[model samples]
Target: MPAVSAVSAAPLPAPPRTLGTGLLLVVLVVAFEAMAVGTVLPRVASELQGLSLYGWASSAFLLSSLFGAVLGGVLSDRRGLAWGAGFSLAVFAAGLLVGGLAPTMLVFVLGRLIQGLGAGGLGALPFAVVTAHYPEAQRARMLAAVASAWLLPALVGPLVASLIADTWSWRAVFWGLVPLLALIAPLCLWPLRGPAPRVGEGSGGAGLLRPALGLALAAGALVEGLRSPGPLGAGLVGLGGAGVVLTARHLFPAGLLRFAGGLPTALAVRGLAAFALLGANSFLPLALHELRGLSLTAAGWVLSLGGATWTLGSWAQAQAERRWGPGSRPLRVRVGLGLMATGLLASALAVLGGLPLWAVYPSWVLACFGMGVGYNSNSLYALAAAPPGESGRLSGQLANIEVLMVAVAAGVGGALIARLPLERAFALAFAVTLLAAVLGWLAAGRLRRTS
Candidate 1:
């Protein structure tokens, strides 16, 4: 990882004495928060009797998450990680409390918005933390640990959420994280040896907010558009297109708008990869439970298992990153996507073949592993391409690409599932995954040198 030390931002601050048990624990708690939501969401919808707005609950979190993450990047780059992490954790806790106590559907949705903002910040802020404080070798290891932190949560989040929802209430799942997030503030201040603020992002970062919002609006509107009827749907589509144009002008370099030097193409591949996988995977739990007749607990376990395998895939990529540097990223990404396609096909075939729900768990795990591998591969290559100072902002933009793509994909995937048989819908998704993998592979071939 140090061979790529040139990629680290200039004159890096000393990292913590060590990543420490506390920091890892903080990461674990956060990852569990992420995984818990999926399990509890259905229960919330059923209890609240707002099935029509079910997708909004998730989409709202995702949208706000985009905002929070991008904002965190800018904030952390300007302020120190301490303040950034502090603000984000407080926001996250408040959202959870609001969600747990909400009495109305609208209130619940608002709470999700708040949580999404926090979640967005929490997700990418860790990357900023690593880049800012840790040495290259230790930073890479911490990143790997951060990846692994998701494993325990992935193993238990669903199961725990399922039990809470079934035996007690869904709201408990939200409230549960409050005490956990409470620790982040104090933990942040303890290792307080850095310069208070790392560096200011200047006008370029500040100017980006409007476009991020536009992108978010475009994404939300695009998903919402799919739900409308007749001319109203057309209106929504038109609005979404405008939002995309607005966001594009702000997000990409001028050359990218003109399709120069594969910038737009790079962004497109990132978007497509996320869309094909995240979009398809979003509805998979429902497919297993609703179509295959698995219990909530069983479905939850399957998802958790998949999450666990995702960590493994990410871990493997870290090793690959060390051994292969930028040269091998494309092959890894291609393989990751190929695995995704294979997993999707296996899942689709299991459904088509009427394999018992219990028998098909491994397929979803494979899909998860594929997603993890491809995702990290994308990150290493993309980050290696950018100027070190731009890493935080570029990461935020890439994150926006991922979340926006998933938003669109989920809506599209949802509609497809509604119209077609579960198996056939899955097959179509698998085909799309294959296409994205091909695109990623082709693009990867351009990266012979680290430059």
Candidate 2:
């Protein structure tokens, strides 16, 4: 019950150090794959031309990834991060190959589902490895470095994918990643060790189910928005909603659902922050290419800036955390969200004011910077708060919950865009981002006081 960490701040997690370079390489390939696809997605959809299913394309990856993360955590807790990560890598690669060759939109989605499944484990496991292997004090820097790895993909992935899609085929984007994964998988071997324990007894019956439910709910909302082909989506939503209620109770702490604790509030804010960022990300490129008539390369340039800005923001956050005390963490996070709200609002204004398409990018860059700062703050906060041995459970649940919100927001937000003019759609996105900022401030405030 005592506050300050019982764990020492020395001897950084053995796993990341032992596997530092290798694990980072793994993170880069994964980040690159995700970033690259974002660049080419607009072109892919343009050719496939299923405007209604656009969100589903991304959500398929998110929803399956939700389940995959839960499964990974449990497996990591049982089989260890090494095996968990390795299995995920295999699945992830299969998904890319499958997606690259998809003839139809539905099949393409199937590939995304596979990718998501793999992603679930891929996304959270590294953080867990870092936590379990290193000292608590080492976490902030290691996590930042982990984040910094994204810098390259952000800077390069878009432009690379854009050029490939324009010159050759979007399929090249996936094909190119195959080798990256092939190399990254083996590097995990040095880090793979024995199983670590969960944060708690893992909540009883529905421990890991919360994320799936969240995914289902998100997909359901998308279905609600689209009224997609059959009732399957609705059914999925109902199941997800019910599961969210029951499983969340077990997955999170006592007051998470109610936002009573700083941890719960912080985690919730993280989800909203993700919603604001990802919903816009899902829409922006499409807006540029589909509506504004920008080529993939042109649109990618905008995305590259956003990625670069994200890194700058993260760098700023890490610097602030290091220079200031622990309280600085939430403060930086709040600042990040405020910036996002401002950026999104600015973009909305530009669109409404009939500003040139190129003019709106500065705001988009700010939004991405906000994401980098806000996400890292929330993640570090969550990981730091978790009891030792529970890093995997806590981080896994956090990742799952956040992604579920993102998937739902994308589907719902994407559809809203389909219904509105460019300005109106962006206006809605701006409003959502603002709300997310307010929530982030409140959530972060809890930590500000607690620390």
Off by over 4 Å in 2: 1-18, 39-55, 101-105, 162-172, 195-200, 203-247, 286-299, 354-359, 448-451
Worst 10 residues of 1 by lDDT: 1-10
lDDT of 2 by residue, 239-333 (tens): 65565566566566677656665677767877778877766766676666755677866776777788778877777777767777566667777
lDDT of 1 by residue, 40-89 (tens): 77777877787877878888998887778777666655665665566777
Report residue 428 deviation for candidate 1 (angstroms).
3.3
Q: After superposition, how far is residue 338 of candidate 2 from its true place, in Å?
A: 2.1
Show the lowest summed lDDT stretch of 10 residues, model 2. 1-10
lDDT of 1 at 429: 59
Q: How many clashes (backbone atoms < 3 Å, residues ≥3 apart in a chain or on different chains) does model 2 have? A: 6
Global lDDT for candidate 2? Answer: 0.71
Candidate 1: global Cα-lDDT? 0.69
* lDDT of candidate 2 at residue 333, scale 0 to 100: 77
Residue 89 deviation, candidate 2, in Å? 1.1
